[model samples]
Target: MSFVIRNIDKVIVGDGKVLSNADIYVKDGKVSAIGAGLTVPENVEVRYGSGFCAMPGLWDTHCHVQSSGGIWGVDKDMLPEAKAIRAAAQAEPVVLSGTTTLADAGCDGNISFALRDTIAAGIVRGPRLLICGYMIRMTGGRAGKDTEGEVDGPDSARKATRKMIAKGVDFIKLGATGAVSSPGMKQWSPQLTLEEITAACEEAHKAGLKVHSHAYGDEGINLSIRGGADVVVHGITLNDENLQLMKDRSIQLLATLSTYKAKLPYLDKLPRWQAVKHIQVCELLEANFKRAVKAGIDVVAGTDSGMTFNYFGRSSRELDYMVEMGMTPAQAIKTATISAARSFGLDHETGSLAAGKAADILLVRGDPLADIGVLGKAGGVAQVFVAGRLVAAFDECGKEIG
Candidate 1:
């Protein structure tokens, strides 16, 4: 099957440049050719996105569809069945909203990937799956205080990484610091020492995979980077030393501003002791990100969607927050399109609208370069193509097959 989308208002190309009055050709699910006014071949699927703007489909670097946790709090027995249901619900709004690739945050383990496989195999429509198996944690580590990621030594960590690799996980996740929700645990508190994180990263890399660590403080950030993590999920609090290390090591950051936005309304409800912690996180994130940009560190746009106070699939809001934080609209788009793919090492395949890449693209209604806010508006996607298949049309929900 082939498609020749003609007369697109603007085709946002790979280098973050938009071509006016363009046409795109797709064959065998790869972009065969893209130019202006090519002679249309008979019998190819043709569509006119006249009032639309095209760009690479949106990508969400961080999200958790389901795991042993409820919508807002911990749900210890997050069975595969429950996970599948939640993932299904989560997949719709994202796909319909124009996202094609979404990276699952630290969820699923060797013990729970069949559920992920089921969601991938079934009728769910959204981003392609790239998931971290169960989070690797130290005994009484950061993720769940009650339910410990307690691996005894380096050997145990190695064994756990092997199990996740054997299960065919896309990457590995390690919990490096205590989180806000985990009561009595302070943010930036290091959970796994250098040796443990090194063992896990080495084992995963040896098997030709990458590691993404959930770190917060300077200690956690430095240890994860030194251990050779490909990306640091959310290290909001960093000192000059850690910032330099991150820049020197070339580790990317997934700054999740939306997570903080969602928590604002509940500030009064938080325990007196924890109230300051939330405020501190918000302040540090804004300040540290400005420093990261100044230091030439690559920062990707990621919304920790599905966390407490965040919407399920509407991650476009993150782009708006990025502009408010000092990134230009073009820079914010680049973060999601180009920089984001580099973070996952998938830049060669799906990041931008380049020839020979997978035809994962979206058609928004206006010029995103003028205002990033246009992407967050409803009905922005006129159509969404995943691997050359017009899975969803404008204002359409699911696949439309005859």
Candidate 2:
């Protein structure tokens, strides 16, 4: 499992530095060297990198890996075997699209955990997965009481956090506010009380795990910040005070802008209530995201893929929306690379093209800095490698070749 990509035209270091005419050497599942004119190792495969731009593989921090149903939501009664099969199949396209790592925001049962383990065991070909077993929510809150995440009071929340930790979750997801995808849930109203949210955060932090709070409105955002949330997912309405607090606490924002934007094309097909909320959120997202950028908030790119029309394999489209909102192409790319890894405490292992880091890299055909949309365009991704192993390769027409 060793190879050298020789004579790359350009190399995006994934930390705002792009080197020209460089070579990347990967051995034993880690990057060994990244510079020009490196000595070739004996018996290692050498791949020509001419006309290719090598970069760190992308990351998507917010996704539902086990669910794929549209606006009506995933069928709760679906058989577990069927769910596992469908979920594994759905993840293949994501890695093929150049995303090397992704986080499952929430999932039912043990599907996501099973998927993550199987991928690690090489039972399946997919991106590196980080998952929260189930999102903690108030009774009658988002996703309803029938779900496993229903918790009320501080003690209940703490217990729920422990349960998820016992289940081997990577992080804890708290539903601080209602969501647009949930019918009858008001997006502006906070769902989990400050005490409840704080309890979950405290328990999770004690276990050395970060907490991602699903919040949109100002009230929910403030509650989450005060509750010690490490990251705010879909933080759409950040006021001046909340923005300042986030800056002071170094709280990162995972803006799932592509979630709502992806639904625009099928607005007519959605229920009126959901469609209206999507439209309103889209408008608010652009303005608020611009404000977040200006306020110097660390914004990470995440697509709520598997939600409605926000399909997998198009996760890079979130970076496109980020560039359109306010970021430069390079900045947007960093959001999905270095910034994302830092938010999730994976920077030391992956995220950038550097020696001693995992050899998770993507080879694209063109310069994404010149046109950010190239990431989302067909045939843009040339090859994808995870841990120095070639997982996927695409033809010129965006067809999977390996």
Lowest lDDT 10-residue stretch of candidate 1: 67-76
**Model 1 over residues 1-402: C-alpha lDDT tens digits?**
888888988888857577988998888888888889877578888878688888888788877766322333445566656767766777777777677777776664332354456546755666676777677887766444343245667888888888878877778888878776555678779887888889999998888777888888888888888878888878887778877888888888888878887777788866554567778798777888888888888888778776666766677788888899899888888888778888777888888988889898888777888888878776566677877777677553333323
The number of the candidate with the highest lDDT is 2
User: Against the hidden reference, what TM-scores do the models get?
Assistant: 0.91, 0.96
Residue pairs whose backbone atoms clash in candidate 2: none
* Pairs of residues clashing in candidate 1: 69-75, 108-134, 109-134, 139-150
Residue 54's lDDT within candidate 2 is 91
Per-residue error (Å), model 2, residue 61 = 0.9
lDDT: worst 10-residue window of model 2: 69-78
Stretches of candidate 2 exceeding 4 Å from the true structure: 74-76
What do the candidate models score in CA lDDT, each in turn?
A: 0.76, 0.89
Q: Clash totals for all models, in order?
A: 4, 0
